[model samples]
Target chain A: MAERKRRRALLRMGAGISKSARVADRLFLPVVAGAALLTMLLTVFHRQIQEIVSPSPQPSGEQQGPRADVVAYTVDKVPISDPDSPVWDNIPHSRISLADQSIIKPLKLNVPAEPVKVKAAHDGEWIGFLLEWPDSKADTQAIKVKEFRDACAVMITSYPSPPEARFMGTANNPATILHWKADWQIDIEEGFQDLEKAFPNVSVDMYPLLKESIRDGKPPKTVDIPEFARVRLPGTWAGNPVSQLSKASPVEKIVAKGPATITTLPTQDAAGWGRWRDGVWRVVLAKKMKASDGQAGEMVIERGQTYSVAFTVWFGDGGDRGSRKNPSMLHTLYVE
Target chain B: MPKVYNWQIGREMDYWYEESRPRRQAAAVFDTNKCIACQTCTVACKTTWTSGKGQEYMYWNNVETKPWGSYPMGWDVNILKMLGPQRWSLEGERYVYRGKTIFEAAAQSERVLGYLPSDLDYAYPNRGEDETNEIVVEEKFYLRMPHDLWFFYLPRICNHCTYPACLASCPRLSIYKRPEDGIVLVDQARCRGYRECVQACPYKKVFYNHVTRISEKCVLCYPAVEKGIWPRCMRTCIGKIRMFGYLNTPEKADPENPLDFLVHVKKVGLPLLPQLGLEPNIYYIPPIHVGNINFLRMLFGPGVDQAIQTYNKAIAGRDLELVAALLLNVSTDRIMTKFKVIGSSEVAGYDENGHEVVRIPLKEPAVVRPFYDERLQVYRHNIT
Candidate 1:
């Protein structure tokens, strides 16, 4: 009887163990599968996230005007006057100053002299001036050009010789002849005399291109220098009723003669000039001007005719005397 | 009998070798007159391929105005001045650099200085006028004179060439052009940034990033290209001036095609300066403007007129049938079948005659959307 009871107990124990094992297997498989599915879903979502964050590989066809972000390749925010600005401080201004000294000696002036005036006038209206180079022992002409350029903060590119005067006539035109002789000097008295001979009707008053600075009396306030000058002639010449051609007026027709090729000036708003011949235009850069003021040559074109236009600009030598560098002037033509 | 057999075998081998070489495909043609300087290509390249650090100053692809503009300042003048009046050699197959004639001083200085004064000029690559100034000139005053004119912008990038100069110049041999796809690539891992590649490239497109200290260039967007997408610059060009596609197999490509005229004829016409010995793949359509004829002749060479004539014939001759046929392959639906195979037609819609019509691709695609997930990543596509 005892043996039979033991056998029953053993059978019951084995049955319980088997039942527990079956339950564990049933629970474990689904849990593991659930975990794996969660991981896979996470991976897929991760990939999607990556794609979203990254820039798209495809191009979008839209005609949005140039974005500001796209435009200015580099701002480089150079400080005009602030000394602390990174770009300003790093600039070779001091080296430029040294170079200035070498250029100044040829003008035959002393270290400190009375201030001279360098006036840029147009039609008797004074546009700008530089007064910084007072009694300095710098070359008068050199100082005149240097002070004027520095005051205006513009570039003055110089070619090797007279034949390569690359930038001469106007500030807005392209370069043509690469050279010019720098033999002529700007003398106020001479300039005034020349003006008297050219324009007899208008009183020719002379002013120095540079003036004394009010704040320091020694340094000049480098402000408001025009890139170009406009001169207007008097209405009377040789007893004839000279037409007061408006410097700002549009002309009906422009004729190109001699070496001068008449081309329309590239203007933002002006109607295009008409093409009179192959590779030729009616408008040309002004050569002679009225003595009262220096102005850019006026351009004229027919109202209804299509014309080719050219832009003209002058680049000066950086105030070097012995280098014999001359300005370069050229024109770039375009159809409007 | 044995000698005859040998001759036949030799002829067969020669023919096989010729056939085995990879053939030129449909080249990218840029009509400079049509280019409006929109700079869509620049931004497209920046955002797509070079958005990372050190790429701020790098323009793997850039557009510079001619006559008065240059990338890295004075690249064109410097190189032209260096090469100094190129001429062909006796072999007639190559043009020699003629080192003795070129400007060694300028070239040597540039190699050492790595920068020039014009590089720092603020006036370079000037943008359009401000709105305030625009209104003032337009409404307030009519001075009877116009102002604020701008120079033309010329878009540029790597020309995955037939004989890549960058590939030959690299000491590490990291730069390579794939034989299968014709895509030029620089293996970044192998590149040490010695900058020999930078000097070697006549185009000066390759640039060194101070941050990365490695030379980088336009990759041609290989990933996107593989997926049938055009490069970012080609797709996003605002002026619709750029066209990208693969050249067809030699058997399929038409030899009579006018566009192939320049490539096939070796020396009697205009070709890339041969001294560099790098056979550049990209071709330029010269700008046509009535200016100093002498200057134009000097810059473009004597064959310019003939090249222009051939180009005009290709573009305007035979009722423009040659150009139309080469540009697009027509089917019943007027859908471009040939260009579509190379991904150009897909981006540019098709014309009635199956020529691929162009539209400026500038904006970023709208399909991308953000989602938060367990991986802390942003998801681009919709979740299933």
Candidate 2:
């Protein structure tokens, strides 16, 4: 009974310890939960507290845009219309003219000459004067501005003020000629006379009626030889004396002249002349013999033989169709 | 007949297709506002690539002044006049020229090549109607208003296009665009100097070298690119304006990283005539100044504002997240840093999800060089 009572006492003691442990657990759990909740609250409010404590960032005017400004604009709002503005002015039109002058001055080019008067077939109002300058080795071919203007003034005075003149410049060189293509015609002789009276030294001419006729249509009946035509050579020949020939004369000496006819008998002799036949002169010669074989020596003609022959040589008119081969006889000649 | 497998098919099948590789190509961007026209790039290119015979008159790379400037006289004016005014139309997904594409030749039955200038036609200097000499030199003469006189130099090179007109127009099929890098090139052995490429190139960059008897052009310095080196022009630029790097591999480069902004979303642009559908790899960042808006519009076209916006975003630190988004083809993560704002800070930490986080500080402003300095002097140095 005592052992049972001791066991009961141990169980009772174990129950009491378990109950205390449970009570301690309940109290510890609440405290842990409260601490955890407090930590969670502190963590949630940390950022808010930092934000409240830290100073707000300075307002950056640059940062407000897409990026911070690297380049500065000093005169951003300057109006182009403002006179004091830094805008550039437009280039004036006068500069173009200056540039043109700068371009043309380097080349030495001259203005054209005025026109002078000339004769025509029809009669009408005078248009203008046509000027002509001859080509020369000297600079005389050049037409001065004053001369051109004076000629124009003269033509204008003679005719109307606004007259048209066609300038026909020479393609060869610097020579220039101005002519009037109009209804009016000037008297050729009278105009020349007036021009010569005014400028005596100037070589001027009025084209002839025949020249005008040729210029109009058909050519002149008689052709005038141009100054550039070539002359023909002479057919005759002259001789110098023998003494002059020895002195180295420029002319050749003539030995003989005849109609070229021969009269001789046919012979076997080697050194003798033969008869002429068939328009040919013939000769004969004898063979020479060897002295050892008792043969005769060969015949030979002597040097410097001057033959005079005559014949009734024929001659032709030598027309376009005639040949020089056959000559008709006009006369006969005799030689001794 | 039984299905016969050919050797070409076998080879084609064996050709390994890199599925992990990015499909979109990266291109170069030139900030014209920073260009100084120092010609250091020009000389470097000349020495490295065009030092041989027949290249005496060729400038492969040249910086031409606007309004009255050209290489080989008036190349721009002559070409612009020949092409007349540009007109455009979108037919489905493709662009058409004069209402016709390359495939439309079947309907027209006309072998229509691109427009070309007459052989005898050339740009000539104004002789003033009385100027005697062929060359009329007037030093520092201004054609427009005095105070408003402004001229910018435009540096030009072959664009190395995507669908290169030069490649298409070549009868010999000598010109090619590399599939790997998208660099357009012509095989020297196959080019017969027909001058079709010269006529066909809208930019007129391809030129005939008389002595070489072959059509030569800018190569984009493939050898230098292979060696992880910038083109001679980009390397030797005195102004440090030109930047060069692989578009996709910009992360591995330093200093002047071209791909950092170019391949990035916010700073991409292209040379004019991209509508020609050549898909040119060269880009130009428009230079902005306080001038007549109409003049700027006329010079750059209607896209000037967008180009300027992109340029500003590139120079400044904004729109960097946009760049990264475009490159990675992903949405911006909370911890992900934008490319534009990646100043001098390093990677800091990772989130619970193991995403990389970075710390960047607002740094002091740095000095960027002007396009041209007032006191800058140009000098010519010869290399033996």
Q: Compute fnat per model.
A: 0.00, 0.00
**Candidate 2 docking quality: incorrect, acceptable, medium or high:** incorrect
Per-residue lDDT of candidate 2, residues A151-196 (tens digit): 1101000011111110111111111111111000111111211112
The 0-to-1 C-alpha lDDT of every candidate, in the order given, reads 0.35, 0.34
Return the lDDT, model 2, position A261.
10
Candidate 1 docks at the CAPRI level of incorrect
Q: What is the C-alpha lDDT profile of model 1 across B218-278, one tens digit per residue?
A: 8878787655556777766666555455544223443333224323331112323323333
lDDT at A3 for candidate 2? Answer: 98
Off by over 4 Å in 2: A1-336, B1-26, B87-149, B246-264, B290-301, B310-384
In order of listing, the candidates' clash counts read 67, 23
Candidate 2 residue lDDT tens string, B1-384:
012111101111110011122233335556566666777777777766654323444577876655455564655555445445654444563333342222122112111124333322222322122222123345523354211444455667787754455765664456776766666777664553445566567666776543233467888787765544456666565654454433443233321233444433343443444333344566665665423444444444344566677755644767544333223211112222223335433212222244444233334245665555557653324312
Chain B alone, model 2: TM-score? 0.62
- How well is each residue in A194-253 modelled by candidate 1, as lDDT tens digits? 211222232212222211111222221222212121111111111111111111211111
Candidate 2 Cα deviation (angstroms), residue B196 = 0.7
